[model samples]
Target: MAQTVSFMAVGRFEVREQTAANAGVHMTSTSPHREPIRVGVVGLSASGGWAATAHVPALAGLDGYELRALSASSAESARAAGEKYAVPLAFASAEELARSEEVDLVVVTVKVPHHLELIRPALEAGKMVFSEWPLGADLAQAEELADLAHRRGVLTAVGLQARSAPPLRYLRDLVAEGYVGRVLSTSMLGSGWIGGATYDDNYAYVLDITSGATLLSIPFGHSVDALTMVLGEFRAVSALIENLRPEVTNITSGEVAAKSAEDQIAVTGVLESGAVAAMHFRGGTSRATAFHWEINGTEGDLVVKADRAQWWYGGTQLYGARGEEGALTELPVPARYQRSLKQWTERSADPACSVAHEYALLRDQITGGLAPDTHGVPDFRHAVRLHGLLDRIRGAARVGRKVTLTEQGS
Candidate 1:
């Protein structure tokens, strides 16, 4: 049975007090929104990318953020982005934008290799920073940035937006409320980035294990994180990783690339709750299903399935069955679980929904003067913890043995 915890809702903000020890884990809190925060987005390109499509739309739809400045690789690109986005200030370099008095929050949307370089300046300036996931090139870099943020006492956030995803959030509550009885075991199977036969030119580097944005690190990472958000952390895990697709054709470049990245990944683990868990991610979509997940408990079961691998993008369906309650039937998310954000409608992408939630949580934290861990916002330390987990999973695969996880944090 799950422990009962009391909570209070203030508008869309939920309030609960958590000790400071859990620095990077999600807690709860409530506070009214304050003045709009001035944001300078690094890599907000006019040419369109993740930042342009997701962050731009997400921020534009939010109330507490003012998209003030943009930074690009070149002065011309910077000026062009500013004109296109209607941002008044633009800089050719991240340092200039981070140091500007006009930028209260620095949003780093650059490539994985550039995160450390782009985010360091903002951290040094004691400005709030939000960087995309795979927070650093590797665990070491991620820890370095996290340590800097901690030392500087500046608020920080990461792109592990899976926690803020609406359906995932609802799923968490359902599990905590014992909707599935006692979670005996959980499993997930999904199509991964490499699952496709062809790849984009931009993702060519992702095919290399050295890039840090591998099949195991991104889609797999995000999926696992989202799973843990609802189920709990793993106590130990055994994993197998293989590079079945050693050679992949780049659809855009019309070239065959030697892919060192693993395309077939599998993991079996024990959750903190003592429930068994297993996950398998493959490079291509299945002929029958794109994604499927099941949670079996002593008295009931819950299932979440999606047509695409990125369910966090607001495209998942829920089903449940209790005792002999016929077959698993669809469970509609209640209106109460829906946040009051006007932009948090059915049309929002998974990234946009999660980003908007993170913004709201940060706005409340800054306005309420709450601690970092006191909300569900995933921060740098959270990224470090995830990095450690990934490392352990890799180790398990390396040694062909189940490894124990003792590292702490979210």
Candidate 2:
């Protein structure tokens, strides 16, 4: 037996209430048991976007989850998406989708600026939520959403999918298993593909620093999250943030615009384990090297490289050398690490591969198969801490000084 929940439109928002008992309706995972987590996605357009390119395929390829509903910017678009994706339900607004009793999880894959508005309603409706990274436009907004989720006592997840990548997972275990014994230092250099001299209309918004979708927040943010995942959190950091290219050309329209976002970000810090760390990220792709990271230890060293800065998506390769070895050799990810992802091996570059892995972990957690504390499954609280760390990096750059992080991540 289950109780049906109804929602009434109150101005711009929806208010939810228990209406009556429903004999056939299935309850959410909040009931402590549910065969499949029904997911309703916000911003899943029929015209194609990140949701179409990644989330849709990821859900389709996974088990214990169903893409039950979707919400686009308009009713027509929603209907188009529902028909296009063969989803059962469609809504014109995110709030409406969030209030639907048929949806157990609300996945918000909208833009960074709209995250707070879209995610708040789902949290208020007491539904599980999964939002893409940069959980909010800024640190304060992320903290606010995290606080509200905490108060509501709901399960929430943030899209830091790099942590779930098989190669990265194997890399983490190698370090933990003493492959790189007594790590001494590590360094990473990457190119911020979008922050370069050329831009498209779709990405023009990121050129404005106030939009909160800058190079530092998206590419650097994602890459650093994976870095911290493998090497632990930073203890203290000093940074130099600069805008080397103030003007960028629009590739499509041939128009020039002033780019306020920083193109050069260099950070030097010490990890919690006392390992020295240095990372430098620059705008535009490098003809020589797009992504390269190395870990040096007393016993050996490890190296990771990719064609692009975004290693989470794919093309990431791991290499290592130890003892008297004069050269580095490729280290294949263990079969066990990629057991569930065998089907995605041929299409490793597809964004859906890593996303599918993340969804699998999420399913395991919801179904009581995996512990909530499992690594790589980041929640809203973790997003807040990462946001705080980003804030500290900005503060350190602004003051030209070193900032130390505390246990509480202030």
RMSD of each: 4.8, 7.5
Model 2 error, position 195 (Å): 1.1
lDDT against the true structure, each candidate = 0.79, 0.83
Tens digits of per-residue lDDT for model 2 on 53-159? 99999999887788999999999999999999999999999999988988988999998988999999999998888899989999999999989986776677888
Model 1 regions lying over 4 Å from their true place: 1-33, 348-351, 369-374
The runs of at least 3 residues in candidate 2 whose Cα sits more than 4 Å from the true structure, single-residue gaps closed, are 1-34, 371-373
Instruction: Give the RMSD in angstroms, all C-alphas superposed, for model 2.
Output: 7.5
- Per-residue lDDT tens digits for candidate 1, residues 174-230, read 898998899999999988856366788777778778778877888789888888888
**Collision pairs in model 1:** 194-283, 195-283, 195-284, 313-350
Cα lDDT for residue 140, candidate 1? 91
**How many backbone collisions does model 2 have?**
0
